[model samples]
Target: MIVIRTPGRLSVRLQPRVLAVGTVCLLLTLAVGVLAVGHGEYPMSPTDVLRTLTGGGSPAEEFIVTQLRLPRLATGLAVGTALGLAGAVFQSLVRNPLGSPDVLGFTQGSATGALVVVAVGGGSAVLAGAAALGGIVTGLLIYLIAWRRGVHGYRLVLVGIGVSAILTGVNGYLMTRVPLMSASRAMLWLTGSLDGRGWSDAVPLLAALAVLMPALLACAPALRMTELGDDAASGLGVRVQRTRMLLLAGAVLLVALSAAAAGPVPFVALTAPHLARRLTRSPGVTLLPAAVIGALITVLADQVALRALPGQLPVGVVTGVIGGGYLVWLLATERRAGRL
Candidate 1:
């Protein structure tokens, strides 16, 4: 362990393995992002993509990269980063493998909100707003229901599961009641694609992360302490409930932003933290590594959906398939270990 300090103002303790994992994940995310940019009908070379990004390419390359692919790539990066940070915070706080945005129904809330807009013929423009509102509302509802004097991990997880199931039903009912065209649009949104995305869709999410990520990072010590249990954490001078509330608020907003931007792209939130933890073999919260892995996973899944398949499948479909397999493997592994 090496400690870097700027006199009395700042100090950072670094773990070699964790640092290495985060570095690798960051590099992989950039590589996948480049591949995504260079891909599609135009198909620029990596050299062309890099050169164009640096402002030294042909007009056509400039237009294609700047106008077409960059916005989508930027959106995917932000969404992934948000989900990863949210997942790391939630999973660490709840101490449950099942504690994720999708499992907790925040994503479902976003879908419900978007479907409501479409059902009322509000069109695509306001769908992001509606989705964000839904997620925020759902998060609040779950938090309220889970609070009994103070929130417990098991109680929070149970409340989330129940709320998620109810929201799933509500989403299905709304889907059935909508018009055929609206239903089709809702289906696509629910599947979470980056299709037809531009700067407008990317900015709000990026802005939300810009505001939220730093606050969450500042709370990282308390977050890791809370994982040691509330009693112990409180004894250590951590305001356990306050920490929980702040973390919950940040996680919810992150989820809302990602859902609004990308329609709740799956598995990235659930898998990123775990993958980061496994890679680093770290017992503490792996926020930076998780965020990097989340970006890599989302971007890579999107690239697969766009380029590796015959008919461009939705990014969510690719993630769902991968996450499902991973989920099953996870369940079996837990069962055999008698932890399930």
Candidate 2:
């Protein structure tokens, strides 16, 4: 661990292996991103894709690469990175592998918010704002309800599961109330597609990630200390409750913004951190590696969604199928190990 300290400010300890793993994941993410941009219906070669990106291509190539593909790529990367970071925070805080925004009702809450906006004939901006509000509200509610002497991970998880079930029902009811055309639009968004996404959709998520990433990184040491138990964390000059609240709030915002940008793209959050931890062989959650892996998974999944299927499918459908299977496998493995 290499510790960097500026007196009275946050100190971060860097692990060499974690940095190596993050670098590898980022390289893989770039490779996948290239494949995603180059292998679409227009079928630009990697060289052509690079040329277009570097402003050296023809008008048609520019339109295809810059206008059509780049925005979608940007949104996918941002959303994936946000989800991955949020998932790492939650999983670490709860000290449970299953802790994630989707599992903890945050995503469903955002979906519910967006669905309500759709039902009321709101525009995209309104929908995004409402989604963020809904997620933040739901997170606060869950935290309050889960609090006794303090928030316990198991209690929070249980409460979140119940809240998720309720929100799922709410989403279903809202769907039924909307007109067919509106319902179709809502359903498509809810299923989470990168289809037709432009810079308008991508920009806000990028901005949010830009601000939140550093804040989370600055808090990383405190977060890691919290894993040693509240008493130990407090003994080490960490304010446990305050740190938990801040981290939880940060995680919720990341999920809300990502959901707003991409519709609750499932399983990225739940899968990315665990995969990162395994890849790094890290005892603690590896945030940067998780973010990179999340980006890679999302970009590759979008490629498959657009090209591999007979008809273009929503990106969420592909992720949902894979994530659901992973969820089942996780349960089975945990049960076998007597960890459930």
Clashing pairs in 2: none
Q: What tens-digit string does per-residue lDDT give for candidate 1 at 1-340?
A: 8789997789889999999999988988898899899998889889889999999999999999988999999998998899889999989889887689988878888888998898888856699999999999999999999999888788888888898899899999998999998899899999898887899999998998888988999999889898888899999999988889999999999999888988989888988887777678778688988888888778888888887887998888887666556656765665335332
lDDT of all the models against the reference? 0.87, 0.85
Could you give candidate 2's per-residue lDDT for residues 39-69 as a string of tens digits?
Answer: 7777988888888889999999999888888
Q: How accurate is candidate 1 locally (lDDT)?
A: 0.87
Quote model 2's TM-score. Answer: 0.89
Residue 181 in candidate 1 has what lDDT? 85
List where candidate 2 sits over 4 angstroms from the true fold.
1-16, 321-340
Task: Score candidate 1 by TM-score against the native.
Answer: 0.94
For each candidate in turn, the TM-score is 0.94, 0.89
After superposition, the stretches of candidate 1 with alpha carbons farther than 4 Å from their true spots are: 6-10, 323-340
Q: How many steric clashes between backbone atoms does each model show? A: 0, 0
